[model samples]
Target: MSLLSFRVEQGDISRGCGFRSCCWTISRAVISSGILFRKKNQVKKGCSSVNDDLFVITDAPIHPEEVSAKVESRDAGAVTIFCGTVREWTKGRRTLYLEYQAYESMAVKKLAEIGGQVQDKWPAAKVAITHRVGRLEISDLAVVIAVSSPHRKAAYEANEYVIEQIKKVVPIWKKEHWEDGEQWIGDQLQQVEYPDGKPMKGSGTDD
Candidate 1:
């Protein structure tokens, strides 16, 4: 996996010249044979993380039930599952579909990183997160997060925390296929705080 270099200036994030390297790893996993393959299922290719906590980035379709099963246990009286999907409309544009990519190694590591934060924040919560890469049609499942805890509130809060963290720190990128054309977007949720300039938020055919 290649390291990403970005600088913060004037309270905005700007990408480094090696910016191309950011998605270079993603190309190998998602752009096989010049095609972007996004299955309706979660794609499982390698070991997920430091724990058997089920944090993964895949091309296969995500099944919430399966993810939930992995984290659910008798010690947990409450189980919360959050599924993120591709919406037909984002901002004002109508997207036909979306293709996602990621720095696989770093992505899973960051996922586990989020898992660590969740456990620390909610001692009783158990968390599992799965993300899919490749082409996804509108309304297709993009992410599944499972959090189980003895208290319902802990499970709920941990679930939200993991999702926000993934969108902020993960290496996953997406291309919005609009009715007119397609463009590669930055991070999972760019609308959020971009402390620095958001250079990767532009759209173009030239990757």
Candidate 2:
């Protein structure tokens, strides 16, 4: 169980910080003993779980309706779903399509761990996560996460947790294609911070 460290921006974890905080407290010993534990926790906190009911694909486009169906379970009282769409701007750059890549096996394994963690933390009915790879146009669905629970709050929190954890832990890479050119953003492995307590900027890759 070697922990990976990552630098996270302040607001980056807004949606799922609560879940991250809870998990971090329980895993503090594991985190504290590892080099770059804070940073790794940041990354882990950002990513969605691989194991649960989640799915990651580098294939063609993803169907939201299908994903929604997969997230449905008889025991669930509520299900929260989140989708990431490819946008046209990044850091003020005019972006074109995006090309996503991932170490598939590792990414899925990590996601499953996240699902298990969510279930342990809350009364989860079901959880599903899916990510798209390959080239994607603007407005294309990049990621989708759904969580079912006995109540709305649990579903909401679990849903938020899944996306944040995905951003942190999954070995997925994205190349931002701009009209001028393209650059590949690598995996995040550091946790740099500002002096005034403000949040940090974009994440870095493990390249």
Candidate 3:
């Protein structure tokens, strides 16, 4: 299976463990479960797992400096950061804004789980992630990830891993607001379900 596919399945189970417990479990699983198992050829190419910390937020702009500070400490010799910003275009469509909704409690819990996995997968100095919710306009800050390690390579790898994992597992829904109309992104990450015995409006049509 692809890396993302494996993560989607295992991540679903890990998210169920609640915030604190999930973190510990993810940490253990990454080390023992071979989630980042590299092939012999990949290992020869010097490939390894990345480690990072995650921060998730809703309806708030993310400050990179704040996340960097949180991930940095005396022991960390290098820090890497990534910031995701809202853009006006997606897939050739003009996006006016984005409306984000999430299962807040579960989202936070899942973020903690990702952080723990980072710690276990590599000798990460520290990791932090933050996500914004509510309506976001073009150029608005949406998400931030920061990682620190004893070397530049580890920091870079961890930063990449955390962002990819969030896209796969975090229980956040995104609605694309366009001039023509609004369409919710109901991908594999966010399944659509309606109330019992009720037919959802626009259920069949692409909104």
Winner by TM-score: 1
Name the regions of candidate 2 deviating beyond 4 angstroms. 1-53, 188-207
- Candidate 2: tens digits of C-alpha lDDT, residues 61-177: 655444545555556555555667776765567787877777767777777777788878885556766777777788887776756666766776787678767778767766667
In TM-score terms, candidate 1 sits at 0.68
Off by over 4 Å in 1: 1-53, 191-207
Candidate 3 lowest-lDDT run of ten? 16-25
lDDT of 2 at 105: 70
Tens digit of per-residue lDDT, candidate 1, span 1-207: 221232111111112210110000111122222222333223343333324647878787776656766664667766666767677765567888878777777777778888989979898788888888888887687877878887766876787678778767877777667888666666545543233432242221122
Which prediction has more favorable TM-score, 1 or 3? Answer: 1
Query: Candidate 3 at residue 22, lDDT?
Result: 10
- The residue pairs found clashing in candidate 3 are 51-158, 53-127, 53-128, 54-129, 55-129, 55-130, 57-131, 59-133
Off by over 4 Å in 3: 1-54, 188-207
The CA lDDT at 138 in model 3 is: 84
Q: Which stretch of 10 consecutive residues in model 1 shows the poorest summed lDDT?
A: 17-26
